[model samples]
Target chain A: MALAADPMAPIAARVARVRRELKDVWTIDIEVGSGGFPFAPGQFNMLYSFGVGEAAISISGDPARPNTLVHTVRAVGKVSGALTRLKPGEFVGLRGPFGAGWPIDVAVGSDVVLVAGGLGLAPLRPALYRLLATRENYGRIVLLCGARSPRDILFRIELERWRRRLDIDIEVTVDHAAPDWRGNVGVVTTLIGRAAFDRHHTVAMVCGPEIMMRFAASELVNAGVSDEAIYLSMERNMKCAIGHCGHCQFGGDFICKDGPVLTYRHLRDRLARSEI
Target chain B: MDMVQSDERSILTRAGLDALIGTLAARGYRVVGPKLRDQAIIYDDIAGVGDLPAGWTDEQDGGHYRLEQRDDNALFGYAVGPHSWKKYLHPPRLQLWSAKREETGFSISHEPETIPPFAFIGVRACEIQAIAIQDRVFLEGPHVDPHYQVRRAGAFIVAVNCGKAGGTCFCVSMGTGPCAKSGFDIALTELLPGTSEPIYVAEAGSEKGAEILSSLPGRAAQPAEIEAAEAVVTHTAAAMGRSLETAGIRDLLMSNLNHPRWDDVAERCLACANCTMVCPTCFCTSVEDASDLSGEEASRSRRWDSCFTMDFSFIHGGSVRASTKSRYRQWMTHKLATWIDQFDTSGCVGCGRCITWCPVGIDLTEEARAIRDAPAQEAKP
Candidate 1:
């Protein structure tokens, strides 16, 4: 396999450490160079291993922490499984911080509504942290998270901390729950009916499974949020972080470069495609 | 400017041309020209002018190609080959990204060296158009491919006017050939013996071409030589055995997406990717990764990928185009219909390289004709 000497290729990163977040899900924290990989919230990196293949994974670390890059991956395929088994001091290839990220500047003054499902919360975590760090810049911050079951819920400790904060409204829901569960037990979409929001002045950033985002976006729209004000993180098979490889193309736009974060209006038609 | 006679435009005699090549080699320019490679003529680096396929000519038709030796010993005895100008400019596979593990962490590797200047010897008019089309894709786009730009910027084209058109060639219909056009820096028309005039008409289309010509031993072409060049072009146009009716071809293919002809062709199509491999303008690729046995380090690379492959359109669980019919449809639709929407021009240059190189000999023009002639089917009420 010949490598095209790309100018935008990211430096090789090593898994300095690994922490298991859940069963089969591990968080690999890589220690890059001094000025760690600087990436905006919602941008993804293409991680590759020799013999195995490459995958587009979101950078889950806060942009403020540049030296330590973190990625929470579920072991599904050869590359992801190989990545999970990577020990401390193991080397892996990385290329990116590619694609348009969340519009932090635009969301500064508006009330932020973060809607995430399951592992989708990984990419949005950075944005949530960024907003919390600059708490005085924005209005009330609302985080509505959903998971398949009580056991699948991520960032449980952080969710509890956000709930204790005066300026944040955090809601956690699960599709199915045990008899011992005392918290909200319903689909994430059902909880949307009870939440109070200033739809006109709010920016809703949703991520997760495509079906979840679509249903969430529809719920947000019905609640009076405009399509332009709703942002969604799209998932696609991206081979090249650059626009040359046609794998990630949704019609004319290369999702790898043009987006992973796109306005609901921009990707409405493309998202309607059966397989996109 | 007064056009000189063809005999007067001899910057280098047949022997002098060989000497000039030696001079070029001494200067460090890798001189590449047409040579017999594999079973067909291909461009490769040559030590001298004698390396050129002297008396070999090719016969091409829809799904057919053969090479035969001509009695006359002409330097450029053959028509175009499967290889295009892209082999030098936009290579089939390039390393766009590389990364290596470091003590502190991992460091990504980018191309450190600039592309070396090269001299192309036997480019044709249709291929010039193909190069221009690629320029739009690589250069004019929002994100420029620095690798392609560097190589293309340093390339020196020596275009040849077609004196004989192949059976599958429809450059006349595509308005791309039979004669050297504007994109080339320098153009040449080979007028061999036995004709009313025997000469090689040469002209500079760019300042660099003018400089190269001034350095060489050529003079201004005569009026008769210019007329002879025109006659050769006209003769080649007349010799074209294949012609595509480009009149509303875009719309015809776009509207007839469900035509039964595509299924018929799909049955014969091998999906071997030979057509795309030989085509001058099909530019699709896929990336792969490689690691040492220990999995301590890894390298990611890209390779030429064809749309015909089952893996090309694979999404989550299965491929979007699972059947050979759908894959062929997508490839053809993207080439003839959707390409106009993406790029401003049609993807096919009517060079017929795809038709001749296809293992099953699936002819695009024949498929188009079949769809065009098919009767309209009524929808069920």
Candidate 2:
């Protein structure tokens, strides 16, 4: 019975770089002063904007480069807006590397299908980076991204660079676009039907709006993927990322603790129910 | 965990009761107990035995609470009140940390905890169970709440066996109380309070309690006196005011999430959050940030929050639980159904505070019975 360090206390991490990804989204690289922040693929950090508040933002940086602690934030709320407005030299309080991350080890030697929608892609970026760095370990890596429009797309350059790789297959879709658009023009779930991957061995990781995840999961199920092979990254309002705050509860599970990456087999019954 | 050593029993008189309070106060502990305050029994700092509500008992029902005079001059005659021992351990408001703007970025520092050890007097058995439930939530979880740990680590407990059940009590149905089962240093049962020679049959539940009892002016209780103490709890067990059938309760509520009974309860539930505030085990909280007018320093603090609030489940666009039916359903399901899945134990101890303190008189036991009686054909979306 020894006392542990305070879980709520935030360490001051100085912002090293801020890249504006979209109109309101900014990708921030923070220096945690310790020079190394070891975190898994999909774990999130509670980013605090000084006096504004805290928001649960996923660690979007590459796990190999632990010094470059990164978080991509959308200015959808007060705390996130403040974080997005931060400059390169400003400081923000950081408390995390929290929650269960994506099952990268479980997907070894298996084909990986990553379906991301809007800001949801930021959380999945770390996992994709890991899959590509260890390209020889995994099978066909397919990434399908969906945005409201071409302008709303995140990591546009990175998507193209990854698509250039012969081992990976990448597809981008927009819900609505101008006539100049020359790619997929439907929901991200539609790409699941035509994606080139072994349906029997593919481990699908989907992240997006709850509605989009539900439809994508249903589409995956229709594509001959087992329910246990499909994993979804869910979202909810959160305060304490350490599970002390009860805000992120989804039925029996605390998304902050048990998830934020849960299998469809685990969430199938609870996910279909509304207002859970 | 069952620390109660029933083999050791003693009888204490009125003079001995005063000595117990005096001894606790001398040990540098803040002795808190029930007191007559604002026409109700509230837990507060007590100086002596005079602060105890002598002959007052509370009459409680769904959405109704009144203080009544009892025939006997028993100190702890009433059931639980609106204020629970949580107000001392997990305070309604606590400062987590503070930050000051500096030249090179900023610096953060936690609020140095300075809480005195408390000696909770007159704690009910159901209330003790509630404290244990909170211990699991705060201490036994993956990440412990440091502030709660500091406040709860050194507290002393003195559990009082109930003489009569409250109008809304269901501790027997919850298998929590009527008698002090465990989690107390000492347990006391008031006996013959109306007679000239009133006494308290006491048992030490821990070594600390045995030491304190040895110092108190009490004698070994006769076998007849021990039977009287047991009889008091037996009478209370048979006199539960309400009961909840817990068999298959988890599946019953989880399977009927969309039952119409939720809508019926929502019609009466004002969602004032009074029930959550009064509930002994409701531990949800929200944090707030405050800064000086000069904007040089800022501090963040946590305040008790309820599921009834729209902001409790707010994401970016709007609240997840926007409708009253959804909110009410969330509260009840979390308490009775999902809580068991999350904590491995039911969140509720059946203290009945939620039923009695609800302004609209919405009783969960009735709502549960309604859904159980007529479950929906299939869970609607």
Q: How many backbone clashes does candidate 2 have?
A: 0
lDDT of 2 by residue, A1-276 (tens): 233478887888889999999998999999975568899999999998888888899998899898889999999888899999899888888888998999898899999999999888999999999998988889999999999999999999999888888999899999999999998899999999999889899899989998899999999999999989999998998888777778988888899999999999889887887777
What lDDT, from 0 to 1, does candidate 1 have?
Answer: 0.75
Model 2: residues >4 Å from true position, as ranges?
Answer: A1-4, B1-7, B377-381
Whole-model Cα lDDT of every candidate shown, in order: 0.75, 0.88
After superposition of all CA atoms, the RMSD between model 1 and the true structure is 4.9
CA error at residue B340 for candidate 1, angstroms: 5.4
Candidate 2 on B203-283: residue-level lDDT in tens?
Answer: 888888888878888788889999999999999989888899999888899889878888888889998999999999889
Fold similarity of candidate 1's chain A to the true chain A, as a TM-score: 0.94
Point to the candidate with the largest DockQ: 2
TM-score of each: 0.82, 0.97
Label model 1 with its docking quality class.
acceptable
